[model samples]
Target: MQQTPSVLTDQLAVEIARLGIVGESSDIGTLHRVTELACQAVPGCAGATSIRWAIPSGDAGERPEPLASAASHPDLAEVADRQLARRRGPVFDVVEHRRAVSSDDILVETRWPEAVNDMLSRGVRCFSTTPHVRAPVLVTLTLYGVGARALARSQHAIASLLVAQGSAAMSNSLQYDSVHRTAVQLQEAVEARAIVDQAKGILMHALGCDADDAFAEMRRISQTRHVKLTALAQRIVGDQGLPEITERPDRTTD
Candidate 1:
């Protein structure tokens, strides 16, 4: 689950390592690199952006999961977001259904009539969403400022590999997030626990009980009152009164 790539995968590894892209913090760099590399490696792939559909992890159902975008280009991200909101673009559908999505002719997919028309209006006619091997993830390589006919002359394998690498990078990013968060939580827990131990020592001295008994007493009260251990420690240490709990803040983007 380490995001580090092997030496044999030297090509991509070299680029990622050069950018210092190890995890979610490196997402932007990863996106930019993917697009640049994809364009160079795959024919007719004017550019690519890392994009995800209907990310369950997104807060408030507002932002499009994570997309590998070249930049904070409003036109590109807006089109992608609109397609998802409209639920009518092949990119969204492919990512949502976890399938290889291609449109040799976007006009043929009747299900996305409204969305397709809108896309055509943007001067982008043909595109595809290739499923990343480490999926539930997808990459949509948009061939724009050019016609889909150009894609017909290109190598299919190269395109597939471009998407595959993008997927791997995305999955690795997620795994990095998991590990980073676990570490932060472990540190926080240890700190909170240290304080709790201090408070327990105070109680143990006051009540003449053993360490185990003191800890057990804290657990009993926390469980009975349905409060978290850290919160309890705060109250006992700072004498702060307990109040309502708010939505947990997302530390990923933060």
Candidate 2:
């Protein structure tokens, strides 16, 4: 079947929007949506799998990990597992080359001997892959088919566009996660500082000492009791009420 580029683009946009909304609730769910979208968007795609490759750090090599996957058939998952074990299949090539790769008949493909043999045994015939490079992590979207000529030959253009849309969604998710983590850390710091300050004020009034002396007393107690200064301060402020002064002949309220 033939579909217009605009139609595919529109579908991609809608799918990305869906993933974005789902990401707000669950990141894993968003990735599952991505694999499902790939199966729907790619022509002749019977199954889909997403592989996440960690960018190599220094001299150590980073291995690719399977993040999420969805298959129209059980055999398709077998194909993915076989390729993963071989680590030299179309998906791996896509990651290495940073482009799309396919085998009309995976059983006859010689590029990946081990993987092809496994695919042949599992009755998997066709494979198509597009890479999404998002720095630090490279995501590979793979499609599988049982027919000899599954995906339309030379359809990398449309596949790339689809991959681009998914990549954008993934990028947005990564940014959102980073911002959320930073906000949590900042909030924790603010709360800790506030509690510490409140405890210091309480200690200063109770001990009739300056801020530095109050802090020192808390620190000593914290060490002696093997508790954090903030925790010790909270206990002191909670257990022993702040000193209240009343005007008297011998002592005036200070």
Candidate 3:
């Protein structure tokens, strides 16, 4: 028995949601999977390509930068690249306007003649670009068809649903990356501070001065030698020496 349209859509949604969970680890992986799934799920879709763009904050008018892209076929990838290279075609328009664009017959499409010719040469007769915005990121999913009017409006919901799931997954992945980076930086900072403190203790013992005086002396030496405080501290700890400071100068009151 053939499956009903509702059953097919439900299954597609479930598959896309599963990708969301599995793809949380990688934004690019989500995009690649979405393109592959689009070809399999969307009716009349011969091939698919997706572009992920980073929208700059506080510049609503600024053009978004392309972050990543994936395509199901080489020809489809080439078609999308040519559009980006020329800054024209349905992808560009859809991104700029934040709306969907479609061409039923590229052979006679007037908006982007050159792009149409390129697609025709690559055996793409029709295409649709749909934008999915997920704040700080905008993804455009383009579906390619081999016949005129092959892409029907009836299947647009399926494509949109796929892009939405992909966008959510990408957002979650980016957040995870950012948090991981911040955590690493914080760990490095803590390690650096600990080393610096150890170096100060060594200085206090060698110079017979207080912590503040030792730190001040270390800073002075660091400035004169053009070496980072952390590097100087590490050297002091390793060598167990005065770091070339021969005499213990009078502590200044400040």
Residue 49 deviation, candidate 1, in Å?
A: 4.7
For 1-254, candidate 1 gives per-residue lDDT tens digits of 00111122467546534433345345556556655555555555543445533345555444336444552234555666776566556666665566665666665656677767765666555665555545445455443323554444344555566556655666677777788999999998899878898767755665566787666666766887898876786676675632332222222432
Clashing pairs in 3: none
Return the top candidate by TM-score: 3
- Per-residue lDDT of model 2, residues 47-156, tens digit only: 66665556675655555555554444466667777777766677777776787788898666778887777667766688778887766556677766667777776555
Error of 3 at 176 (Å): 2.6
**Arranged by TM-score, best first:** 3, 2, 1
The estimated TM-scores of all candidates read 0.56, 0.77, 0.82
What lDDT tens digits, residue by residue, belong to model 3 across residues 4-36? 123355666677787667335467778888887
lDDT of 3 at 226: 93
In candidate 2, how many clashes are counted? 0
Error of 3 at 213 (Å): 0.7
**In model 1, what lDDT does residue 100 have?**
63
User: In terms of lDDT, which candidate is strongest?
Assistant: 3
lDDT of 3 at 121: 88
Misplaced by over 4 Å in model 1 are 1-21, 24-29, 47-50, 54-81, 104-116, 119-122, 133-139, 191-254
How high a TM-score does candidate 1 get?
A: 0.56
Ranked candidates (lDDT, high to low): 3, 2, 1
